[model samples]
Target: MSRIPDLPGVISSDEIVASAEHLAGLQTDSGMIPWWPGGHCDAWNHVESAMALDVAGLHREAERAYEWLADIQRPDGSWHNYYLPDGDRDMAVEDDKVDTNVVAYIATGVWHHWKCTSDRSFVDNLWPTVERALDHVLSLRKDDGLVLWAVEADGTRRWDYALLTGSSSIQHALRCGAAVGLATGSPRPDWVDAADRMCSLIANEPLAFQPKTRWAMDWYYPVLTGAIEGEAAKIRLADGWPTFSMEGLGIRCVSDEPWITASETAEASLAYASIGEFATATDLLRWTRSHRCPDGSYLTGLVYPDKVVFPEGETSSYTAAAVVLAADAIAGASPGSDLFVRSSLRPS
Candidate 1:
């Protein structure tokens, strides 16, 4: 099995391995990966960390992470927004909100693992989990074809809004879910239809989703998720270039914010690669190295101009995972690398 390879004159392979190890070390005995020690964990970020482990050739640890997810998944196939490492409440007010995108991302993660290891048995084992999660997510789809952002703790749905970034992510997850279905000979035409409709809204009708113009993720997620493509994807990136990108630094988390985030920068790099702009992508990934810590983990983001660490000066497993995944995509080191670059999720 191929692992993350070295990017000559850029980041070293040893550094990539160390970053993966850093993420793995963050995994608790329950196989959950918190943002940092004593930090809370979320489903989406946990899967991101697991994918990084797979990219680093730590299949055993990665599988254990997935098993953790499967073991703890709610009966409805959704996970709460926050969890403590020790499975205890760290905060007084627990967030019981269930995010549709968070639930849907297991499909992407499971499919990614199968791609990396070519493990059919593993895919088969995970198929039911993927199906149930997607079912929950797709159930949140509105008549306008966009999935609701979240289900509130009161059991009321956030039907009045849909997020561009979240919906874009769910579209990718739906396709991956459908692909998993097809691979297992249990095709889900419903998921395909939902994904196609969601893609149409994202590509043509920008107003369909809630206005989050300030966030960089909103600008690039359609491209990153393969919903926007060709000249349109290029134009999207070009349109938002000045607002989100920082030359020789990294992409900002929000347009009006001076915080440069490693995860957003790394994700933007993948979006660039999706549009065949490898040079631009490579530079973005190279720039993220500045956020790396001595222990090989990556900080969440840096407040610009002052160059100070923001958000409590913490390093995140997801941020380190994003860097590792971006490096893999740029180096073409794994089959899973093409997940971002290609439109494999597009409905046939």
Candidate 2:
């Protein structure tokens, strides 16, 4: 990966590197990056952290992170929602819900690493992991094209509803998976079909996804995942601006809530950049600086007005990862930054 250049008024490249190093320091010897020391790790957030590592030129650590994921993957291609850093089960959350988005994200992470480093060997080795992960995720697809959010511990799909953010994110993952298939001479036309269908569902049928409109992610995730674009994306951002955004503190976690989170703010910036709104993206990124700690790590979010850290003052590796990704997008630092803006798979 090329060196990330400094963005003078927003974040310096040195600070970006320092943030990445902070995340790297959090990774356990087993390669898992928990939310914090003694905290649990989830597959989705773990991949996000690994992608940040790749963007920061920590290729070896990124590879090890993926290898750790590969080592622990369930035979059915699913992972429990959370785990201890030492590869042990996180028993605190008794619910063993296997999240579709968490499983599907490996494809995005694998494809991202390949894009940043051009490591064909890494992609080839990880191809099976991606293939199986997608297989599990696609199996959760309902007839209407929305992927069910999770599989219960009973091995049944959570058919009650799908999430707009999760389904939108899965669409991007499917496209990345298809791209991996094509690059490796392993074409997955089924994944392409699923992606096209999912995009249509996200673009045309908001009602199909469960009503989580109260959350900020529901507003911008479709655009961030490339399901919504062009003028539609601009309109989406405009529609939710008054409800979700605060002037300088960052994006609120919920419209009615006072909490502003680093991960959501960073992701919102990506949504803006995906639509060619670089200035707005930069402005949003500047808000993220307030969430940064003296050591270059980011707080998960803050409760506004009171101006206190949320979740009892946790600073998460995933939150740090989100900031790194937003910086990369704004600076055009890595090929992976284009993952959110690129078109979906074309049928062969």
Task: List lDDT for all candidates, in order.
Answer: 0.86, 0.86
Candidate 1 TM-score over all chains jointly = 0.95
Error of 2 at 271 (Å): 0.3
Instruction: Output the worst ten-in-a-row residue range by lDDT, candidate 1.
Output: 85-94
**lDDT tens readout by residue for model 2, 245-294:** 99988999999988999899999998988887778888999999888998
Error of 1 at 181 (Å): 1.4
lDDT of 1: 0.86
Model 2 bad stretches (over 4 Å): 87-95, 342-348
Estimate, for each residue in 1-348, the C-alpha lDDT of model 1 and write its tens digit. Answer: 485758986678899999989988888877888889878888899999999899889998999888888887878888888887664323222468988899899999988988899888888998989998999887777889888899875558755689999998999999888888888889998898898999999988988888999999999999988899888999999999999998999999999988999999999988898877889888999889889898889889999899889886788889999888888887778778877876342223
- Top candidate on lDDT is 1
TM-score (all chains, Cα) for each model? 0.95, 0.95
Evaluate model 2: give its lDDT.
0.86
